[model samples]
Target: MRSLRLAAATVACLSAVALLSACDPEGTDTGDSAASGAPSAVPSTPAAAKSPAAKSPAAKTSATPAATSPATPGKAGRLPAGVWVDPKAVPLNAALHWRAPGPAKVLGEQGKLQIETLCHTRRDEYHAEVAMVETASLGGASGDWKADETIASYGSGADSSGVIQTTYALMGVFAQGVKDCAATAPGAKVTVVAEDVDHLFADVTLPQADGSTVVVHEFLVSNRGSIAELTLRADLPAGARPKTAWTAPADRQALSDALGKPACTAFKDCV
Candidate 1:
């Protein structure tokens, strides 16, 4: 009986060891699996370990601006005609006279003035005259009068010495016209005495049947498309010559300086 009891106790000890081995396959007592009901020995998948609540990137929105049209030229405003002429620049003894019937004529971005007379001294013994006309155009048609033809005809040829040939050709044509006038009216001779880049000075000699000589001085100037024609005439007792040669150069320069300002200044579109 004592031997049988001892054998029974040994059997009980072997069964307990087998049960512990089944719970822990490695036969080691790592507290991780023993403390928790889950099998901590098996590792989780990589995808399952990631955070399920992580957010995705937001969608992009277009931020480009709309296209616009290009601006047009000469849209600002038109210049004034009076700005091209200053009456104060005329001779002190001269009077301000308007050749145009009305005020300055404005068309689109252009302006025009008919004629302005500074002095028209007409006496039995002497005669004098000074006149001016101005025209401004911004890409439109030219003035009604054909003054541009004369301006265009100038500087059209080349010179071997690089010196610009003055308006001698035009002056010759004008002299012919004066001769034609004299043929009808009698005793009139117009001669182009001097010419430069911007001016033509002429001497008109009229031989009256009474032996007195009528001498007239004429000057034509072009500045920035503006034209000014000045005339001074005096009747000599007999055989007297004109003294305008000495002062013609200085007078022409002064008139040129007076009209040198750009006509576009008065116009917004011109700017």
Candidate 2:
């Protein structure tokens, strides 16, 4: 679970958030994965990832978002190389240059990560009729890296709702898990900055395998029948962070505003 495992594998996401615990010294991946036994047909979510208002900051992080600066929305009507939203196509700052999204893959509801396993709160038992996930990431090419993890999921109404609820619910618990884990692990810190019922934002700092540390900005959003996890990770940037100014595309938000938007008939519909 070391390094949050983002460097090791690219999605299918913040499970729109999945992450490994920092327990393993060798960085063996564990927990927060949506790929076990479940239908690996769609992309999942990651927010650095995985919290609530009580467990999160207010509506914004310490970093102030630029008022006049609007983020660029995803490409309209552009189907992704994968099934759903293109990671590279999300709302982003127009000033910064970014690398294209990596390949998309399948990831779904995962088991407990090593840190969660050590958590005092007992896990819940909730099941869904269909759970399909596909994941991908967008990032900078070098120095001052900005990496975004996009996890999108779709399925039956109940399952999609369940996924969103569980994701929001777990964010708080995961926040605590990070602190407890940080007690023993150096250079690992997680903070839930801002949140609402449908979305969450967190700032995370994790030590890398190469003895480096990276800062990540994250968001977790829940649509009626879908979930989106977005993140921006960088070493040191020159300007304001992006998530502070993030806004989903109008088309996507319009669909999410409804009962079930971004409807997918099958798993591949995401990938």
Candidate 3:
């Protein structure tokens, strides 16, 4: 029993010596750790630690300006085609009424189509009046306007008037047609020479008796000759309710058919 106790004491002393060797006061590292390039006892870091540099360039450059191309020049202000405007709903206040002429009349067989518009006050006083004339050559392409003419005169108050002329040739649709018209307008000997017509949009302003302003837009073909016009007029009395105002003569049937409603309420939303 004495021999056995001595062997156990010697084993405990050997363990203490090993521990003391591992933790020397001079800072010796004895756990198989590397100081330089030797395998470290600690484990390596995860892939998530390397993710910051993997971001996209677009996200990092979000605040930079984009390069732009130069813009192309455009034509003068002209009416945009295919825009549907309801004639009856246009307000014919005193400002627009003073510039239009009396209703138009056709002159010859060459005049293929015509349209007239008139507006008057409740007491039969004429407020606005105008007409349109359209014609094409016998051999012209389908839906082509060889000649379109418009004449308009408008006035403000009971006695004001303004005048405008415009004509447009759809000859441009076919290169040969427009060239023929433009070449002939200068030297043509007919009463309605090609040069007589110019088609364009006109915007005019007329002043009212009370110092307010009224603006009018005319869609017409003009000639160097006679002018017959239409005027837009308003009949609402001073201080009258604006909501009670009425517009006239639009294709109510077309509007009703489009909305699947009765004609009486077809344009309830139009002002």
> Please, what is the whole-model Cα lDDT of each candidate in the order they appear?
0.36, 0.42, 0.26
Candidate 1 differs from the real structure by a C-alpha RMSD in angstroms, to one decimal, of 31.1
Candidate 2 accuracy as TM-score: 0.43
Model 1 steric clash pairs: none
In model 1, what lDDT does residue 101 have?
A: 18
Every model's TM-score: 0.31, 0.43, 0.17
Q: What is the lDDT of residue 9 in candidate 3?
A: 100
User: lDDT of model 3 at residue 35?
Assistant: 29
Could you tell me the lDDT of residue 42 within candidate 3?
Answer: 53
Which 10-residue span in candidate 3 carries the lowest summed lDDT? Answer: 153-162
Candidate with the greatest lDDT versus the true structure? 2
Compute the lDDT for candidate 1: 0.36
Of the two candidates 1 and 2, the one with more favorable lDDT, higher being better, is 2
lDDT of 3: 0.26
Candidate 2 vs candidate 3: the lDDT winner is: 2
lDDT string for model 2 (1-271, tens) is 7666874555534433434432233555434443354432356654423433222221112121311111113632122343334333454535454445556554434433333332222333332211334455565544544654444332323323333354444444444444554565555676776555665556666665575555655555554434555556655334334334444344544323321233332222222
Give the TM-score comparing model 1 with the true structure, all chains together: 0.31
Please provide, for model 3 over 103-134, each residue's C-alpha lDDT reduced to its tens digit, 9 standing for 90 to 100: 32333212222222111111111211122222
Name the regions of candidate 3 deviating beyond 4 angstroms. 1-197, 223-227, 233-271
